[model samples]
Target: MKQRYHVLLCLLGVIGCLLFFPRDLSSALTFTPQALYDLTASRTGQAAAKPVPFVSSGFAGFLDENGRPQYVEKIRYGAAVSSMGIINYDSVSTKLVMRNRDGEIQVAIETRGYPFFLKERLLIISTDRLRLKEYTTDGDLLWSATFPSPVTACAAAGNRFLIGLLNGNFLYLNEAGEPLYSFTPPEGRIKVAYGAAMDAASEASLVVAGIDPQTAYLLEERNGELNSIESFPLGSDLRRNLLVSSLHGGRFAIEQEQGLLVVDRTNLRRRYFSIPGRLLSVQGHPESNLLSALSQDDSDRFVSMIGSESNYRGRLRLAGYGPGTSILWSGNRFIILVDGHVLVYRLELI
Candidate 1:
């Protein structure tokens, strides 16, 4: 009788430890806002003076005074430049490139793709194919590749890369473009390629999150195999018009009818923040630990900078953030960060 009673007590102790210890322990692993903010701020500061203007002329894809496309010239440096729907910026060489449906490349000098330090390489994808390119600081292509199928979207985690396809397929690759593993979705109508990122909390893990037709999927990859899949329903309103803007590193950002959704790969948890009006554009700042949203207001536009739980709204201006949500800087003319210095410009739009 005494031994039975002691065994019961030990079982109860194990249960208590499981319930309480992991919760508190996980909380301690999270980032502290002060520490992140200080690390970011130390690397960013206001520029001594306004940026020197890099001017151009022409509109509607026409050339400017210096014989450059108006759009390209305007965003030559720190712009959120997108082409063929893929967005990326390089700070070392100070260039931004976008791919268009026609397979044309747009290069700009000043740009809105700020917090410029995050993107070290370029990612390009399409419905029937995929490509990875290395670049020099002067807009020179270092190397490029064409993958197997029509790639819908892509994300990079450290030295690993994740690519999602229109046929509900995905491939994991090393930095050198060697195949590690592949996965297929359970459903066929999963035409849209939502988002993907590396799972930092787990070793050799990748998270592919997206809306497949009317359902949302969180697919987990470990040891070159997809072992678990979690599904969530976003209801009619959000499900009907789901759009995913960006996924890189271990972060995923999605835009649905309800608002913007951000998820961390490590925790398998998510957070939603409402937009004041309809969203025009959304992008993730990997290094700065912030997400940017642009909305149309009358003739002008407004940009909102949102951190994990806090919100700050500003007018249609240029801006950038440092890694891990550490620093935020903006300006009226142009916002460009070169070697940790913020450069704002006054333009003479010709």
Candidate 2:
């Protein structure tokens, strides 16, 4: 009788724990935030007042107004300009080349017409009404693919890119610029692709988030096909600016005006956390729903730790510092570009 009573008590305890903590308790790991050096503050020169395009690798970078990699590891700027700086453009097309301090042609893309974006080392050259082209950091032509109809939106990352078309359909392409998957919404449900993200290997799932008439659509790419399309109702005009970003291995983040919506690969599990003010950007944590976001206040931006049990944990250590910043990478250490500075910080959240 005593042994049976003990077993019953242990079973009751387990039930109580699960009822209180329903989520995956194992996800609540300790995450700490650490600060590193600043780019402009550590360098000697001032950047051109104009906003210049910048991109960073692990330690080096090509800041605005210059086509050379500054050895951020050594804290030295303009110290090692590379000889590959001179780009020989094709006579038939108008092209621009980005040369790093290492003299390597980090990017050589022709964006004479339509929209052009230089991300990391890949050059995204697009013709809004037609096709898109991509180039490698070494000026190598990766691939060029065209669409069936007019494209309304487009985004790229890691190993793939996506384009939203006029017919309420979206096309996804690999790093080689080959079209891999296409998804079309139900007839008359048109949403432009405003943001997109995929796992590092592009093997888990691709998230394409967008808006049309205040309705947001979410598409999931899986197993060489697209399925599990979800449409979210909008609360305000913020739905017009729904932005999507990769969260983790099989999750993604969507930034609406009120807060953020995070979804797993299956498209069944999801969560939304309301934010206080206008969010400028959000960097998702590598392991949890917890994230770091930049919120705007009177034209100045501050960092906020979000999605904690408190909903709003607190301000980040480097809050309200960089304007027009971008989170370069997310993992144990997060690198971001604020103004002309590339800052690195250690991140930990529980």
Candidate 3:
């Protein structure tokens, strides 16, 4: 009888101890965010500072055949509609120029969303019409094609090109400008595409998306045909914002309120991250989900490095990022556009 009474007391005491000292569910879990950039590190750059020297203010930049970045500004004839262009860089020896029989061709090329570069070819796509001209680095016109609707954006691989149209039409063409596959988006869905990304590894197939609640479509190139592999819905959260393309590889990013909505192009694997400030613009890795986000923290500006899994890694406070200030990520370099100066920083993860 005494032993039974003692056992009961010990059990009651143990139950009371458990009730008083509960375990935390989350505290036992282990996870570490990717990285944080070293605060003391800074990058260097060059100044493209010079006079506008042109009648019109159409300035753009592109990578050369040798993988060097070159800037082009439109040079205009005095009060005429003719558009001349000059390569405004210190190293003018490797500069490629475009000229026509009468004068300069009236076309300027720039990426509408992402900084996609082709190693060998440059596409001169008309912003106002349904035309595309492929040019070699030496300024040779290789091929040109006209579409049924106005071309919205263009993405290119080696000899393959994917063209998005304003009418929700997608045309997949070869190096010779022959139409391989044509796709029209769903009847009730968004047909007018905002951006396009071509995955060179996926047989030069493409992923395209637009604004109606933001859905992505993976168009696979199979047996010389374009097939709609999947249509991944991005939900209603991405509605009505200015949808731009930031697709690199298996992932694509969309601009959101204070961060980026990065998703896997194949599986719709969503990763949304919020930087600690109002997002101004974003650039990221073309192969991974590493994003260089530029945001305004009150009156100051800062750049934060987001990881592949959408974790806040590190941040760098920018000195003079303001209105009309632009930034570009060239894989290993961060190019900041400050008026006439181009600040280039070798991206280091610290």
Candidate 4:
């Protein structure tokens, strides 16, 4: 009986080693909410700088460094921003040129007739209705033209502008808006266009996501030819209300009916996670691989920052992923940018 008891004890020791030893050995780490909150708070006290304002209808206006309103001048039609921050406007000209921060006129060429801004690129919708027009940053029109269908969305990717259209078409244009190469997508699929990016590892290659009747296609550009690298069907929940926001490099974030999905553009692998509360607004960082979402909890509002894979793991494992999310910043200062004017919030986060 003593010998039997010894054997049982040995077995229990082995089981404990298997269960607990590996976790300690792996050195897995996580982030704490307190740390994150502290980091964000530190950024707040450092004198708020006024952001450039582009105002239109309602209360659409930007604030200067002194908190003065800077309204968009000569606004003929109301402009709408896409989920990815693309601004779309309706006008008669085919070729439109607008000034940038450097005071240089950046020309936008449209094949179809649509005049829209994607990222920083002004896209011409249809080639048939193409018209050329020059404008100053102060909304002065210097020149105007009419062009044709197959209008494309343009965005500033690195140094060059990537132009894409609805019909699986693409083009690379210089800063002067001169076309470098015309790109065509594969058969039977329409290029979503908004989520295109240049591969981080290879600037010569481009990554773009498109959708067919049933599946999403992730394609890679090699020497101008688009090769299908990954494809997957949209989740049933996502398919119901598929709204894609920002696409970073090869990864894209989408707001689905179920929650948010972060997809790897190269291999089509994905990670699915959801915020506890309803998402009010979402934005992506331009230089970093992070996503910040604004959500409201009960009566309070909060900002949640989800960094890259490493930052996410750090937060979840170390700090403990809790209800809702780790509040990055919150205040009763309800400020909602809708239809132009900033709607103030009555709730405050103490």
Question: What tens-digit string does per-residue lDDT give for candidate 2 at 1-350?
Answer: 68545544543443355346432323553333233334533444443332223332223344432322233332122111222232323323456666554434566555643324523434444435666666555656777677777665666656667777655567777777777887655423345544555555555444343344444455555665776466655554443335666665566666767576667766446677776566667776656556777665554455666655346655533334434555533445545554444444444435
CA lDDT of every candidate: 0.42, 0.51, 0.51, 0.41
lDDT of 1 by residue, 1-350 (tens): 69545544543453355345421212222111111001012222222132222211110111122221222222333332222222334444434455332224645433222322213454432223555554444455444556655565566556666677655566767667777777665542444444454444333333333343444556566665666556555532332233454444555565655366766555667777776444555655545555667543334334565655445433333222212111122221223222122222222212
Deviating ranges (above 4 Å) for candidate 2? 1-38, 41-93, 101-121, 127-129, 148-152, 155-160, 174-176, 187-191, 201-224, 236-241, 287-289, 307-310, 316-323, 327-350
The TM-score, computed over Cα atoms with residue i paired to residue i, of candidate 3 is: 0.59
What is candidate 3's local distance difference test score? 0.51
In order of appearance, the predictions have TM-scores of 0.47, 0.62, 0.59, 0.47
Question: 2 or 3: which has the higher TM-score?
Answer: 2
Instruction: Rate residue 57 of model 1 by lDDT.
Output: 16
TM-score of 2: 0.62
Model 4 error, position 231 (Å):
3.7
Report the C-alpha lDDT of model 3 over 260-309, residue by residue, as the tens digit.
66767666577877765666666776555567777776566776777656
lDDT of 4: 0.41
At residue 50, candidate 1 shows an lDDT of 22
